[model samples]
Target: MIIKTPTSHTFVTGSSEGYTPLNAFDGALLAAGIGNTNLVKMSSIVPPGTREVPITELVLPPGALVPVAYAAMESDIPGSMICAAVAAAWPTDPAKPGLIMEYHAHGHREDAESVVRRMAEEGMRKRGWEVKTLKSMAIDHRVEKIGAAFAAVVLWDL
Candidate 1:
């Protein structure tokens, strides 16, 4: 089987409360505008020369398999906070692949985003690459009953 490398990436985030954990997850995905597609979890790597796209501009067909690096969390405790975040750090060298990081915890969206951004930077540093740009998205949900938070870096081909 031949795998085609993605040529672009986009960030998305959403949070919701529902009757069950799975329902909450589904609601969050719908809020994120990615409910219909199948999320195929992928390792954290952004190919060299990949472009950034706005979530509104990046379209996917219903039931399409989408590659994503993401973070998600679910909580059933009333009034408790749950957060998820994803970050991408592009290298200074155009030929070098970028790094992506995901983080999730019981916290604020800002905290989750901070951790993932730092994670991306550290990942790039570990690869001996200097970061030129960094982008991230995060979501936080307070559980009325069951709640979920989700964030993702979606990869797509041209």
Candidate 2:
């Protein structure tokens, strides 16, 4: 499910007509066994409604050994379950050459956002994804924000 973090709403209302690298990432993780075996898909829940938007709706196998982030409104951090949720929430768009998954994270204590960012960067590096270019993506964390939160994005070329 798409957890609308307190940080930004851009990812919430963004266009639905784009590729979904998030789906690719999910597939990769599952294949690598970084997630559970009974993971459910959530791409259909992007414009997450009230009750259906819950993280459990996008269930992945629990007890993952990986570092799972905490659940917070301001950030959709990359816990193993959240990653599964992201993979589930991911949708495929033909507009781009690849798929994309975008979300945010909260780091109230220590550098939570920074940690997630580093993990993503390192994970990508381990996967051998060279930085082709840096594009300015958009996110809308509502006003009156506190603590540390950051937008996270992933893309993959099919």
**Judged by lDDT, which candidate is best?**
1
lDDT of each structure? 0.91, 0.27
lDDT of candidate 2 over 1-158, digit per residue (tens): 33332211111111111123344333333433333433222221122121222222333346422222222223222221211111112113322121223334322322433343444444445545543322223222322312112222221111
The model with the greatest TM-score is 1
Residue 54 alpha-carbon offset, candidate 1, angstroms: 1.2
Model 2 quality (TM-score) = 0.24
lDDT of 1 by residue, 78-123 (tens): 9999999999998899998989999999999999888999999899
How far does residue 2 in candidate 2 sit from its true spot (Å)? Answer: 14
Which parts of model 1 are misplaced by more than 4 Å?
A: none
Q: Please report, as a residue range, the 10-residue window in candidate 2 with the lowest summed lDDT.
A: 9-18
